[model samples]
Target: MADLLTPGLILAAAATFLFAGLVKGVTGMGLPTFAMAVLGSLVSPAAAAALLIVPSFVTNLWQLLAGPAFAGLARRLWPMMAGIVAGTFAGASLLASGDTGASTAALGATLVAYAAWSLLGRQPRAPARLERWASPIVGLATGLVTGATGVFVVPAVPYLQALDLEKDDLVQALGLSFTVSTLALAGALAVRGAYQVGDLAVSTFAVLPALAGMWLGQEIRRRVSPAAFRRWFLVGLLLLGAEMLLRPLF
Candidate 1:
């Protein structure tokens, strides 16, 4: 594992996690997307995904323990979780077979599109009749991306924001969604034999930076205004997406 931690890579991972965690702390989402988009440039996609597993797990655990809304969220979101499980399996299988370029491209494009729409104030409108059916689609898309790239919030975040749930409930739902999807992805990866002993070891090592970032983010979130946070978060997402798109080209 020491061999895996070159000084430069450690610094890069620390910076990426710090930024990613800051976004999540301020806006209640986007950690994986921020971290993976940055770290994927430095590491293999699979490794990047694996590195996120423990940090996401820890954060979700904290969320669950933080309040009572998890039960309500579970009741309302079971269908979405089901879809995520199925789609994650499919996505993980694809990754395990050693072809992830297409998925990476899709993730990059989706992030860019999402950031643009968000900046333009084009949030998804609440659908009266279609509300019941939307969760499955969001779940499927999120899970597929989660499995492919270890970042699954893109589909669900916009809709979650649009629904205007109470802030506590919203946080609960986001945490539950990420938790379930992460578990599903890990299961899928296991089924596909994507995990190696060394990879697991390296992943454990990655947790330190992630936790540090989370702590730092908590401090920063206290000082930032919501509007300011949103502006910076969108800028970060756009730059992250642009970086992803340009990486393959170069």
Candidate 2:
């Protein structure tokens, strides 16, 4: 892993984070997923995960705070958040074990499933009664996936969507969920001894570009059609996921 951090690679990573941030700015999500997907192709999934900590955390924290109903949302989502932290801790070693091949495959598979779900416009419903039991389960599953593959938008996002939240509420919920996932993943990396000092510095510096791109993306969102951009984004994720899924064969 030490040998992996060349200057050129670091530069590329900064640029990637910028683009990922842009995507999130436009859509309110996808920063982690897009960055991890592209960076996993350039670096190991574990390394990519390390790079994401600061930028993802900052952006998501902002998103989480921008909503009007923070206290209520947190109260409602506590069970799920706790489950995510516990499950992430449990499965952390899978990602930190230097098993790049398996981690990449897992990530690719996750991206594919998410993209397909979005593209197909499938919105599974979960009643209010189901939230008590379902939230924790979804969080645990999402955390396990995050710990394994450095991506955290599987069953959790879909499950949240299933609850039929209003548009503003849904965006804030995603921010809250992702913020928790980022923190948990960071903890997992620390416990696994995968978060190196130098990587932390780079991750911090990368935040600048990420924020810049996000600002630009917000401007574009005001002018461009977000629905069209999201369509293209999903398509790109689908293709990227397919490539990674077949990477071992090639």
Candidate 3:
């Protein structure tokens, strides 16, 4: 139990969550990705992921329950959920082995790949029949990344985005996926001893600023073009990912 609540970490957590929340507020997503990019730059991936536990859980839980698709989502996504849980545990074991350099590289690669796909690649829509075979694979990959880096996007977002659900249903489906990912990641960190009492306290404290920023971002979302905002956000993530990928080389 070193000082997990140091002033530097406090500031990092507050600012990172606030910004992450703001991004989510306007774009309706991106908190985990943004938080990890900012905080992972400042802290270890393990620490950054741990710090995100409270906020991620709190925010995404609301998103998960906002609609009537909970039961439908549960039935359809159970395979993916199961994969996320299992893959998170496996990735957590890798993280706990004290090989953070590898995990960091993996995180960077994930970010770069995701950003590249988002910017230049087209995500293919699977027929609903194919999801049964495809969903678990997507969830497992996303979980491995989430477990290693605390960033919860990658195949999961792309997979969800490709689904032909109605707008509201798509949003809720992502929320459901994220909620499951957050819980799985938290369990992984807890097992690895990276998430302890002090971290939990700080994570709890961080929830307020994250929520407030989301509120403010919601207000600003009305004024900003979502298309423009998305492009900028993707570019920012691309830069962050490139930096992450380059760091180990130097």
On TM-score, the candidate that comes out on top is 2
List pairs with backbone clashes in candidate 3: none
Query: What would the TM-scores of all predictions be?
Result: 0.87, 0.96, 0.95
Task: Give every collision pair in model 2.
Answer: none
Tens digit per residue, CA lDDT, model 3, 186-217: 88888878778777777888799899989988
**Ranking of models by lDDT:** 2, 3, 1
Residue range 77-181, candidate 1, lDDT tens digits: 888888898889887765566665655665577677777777886656666466678888888888887777777776777777777788888788878888888
Give the count of colliding residue pairs in each prediction.
Answer: 0, 0, 0
Error of 1 at 111 (Å): 2.2
lDDT of each: 0.73, 0.89, 0.83
Model 3 segments more than 4 A misplaced: none
Error of 3 at 187 (Å): 0.8
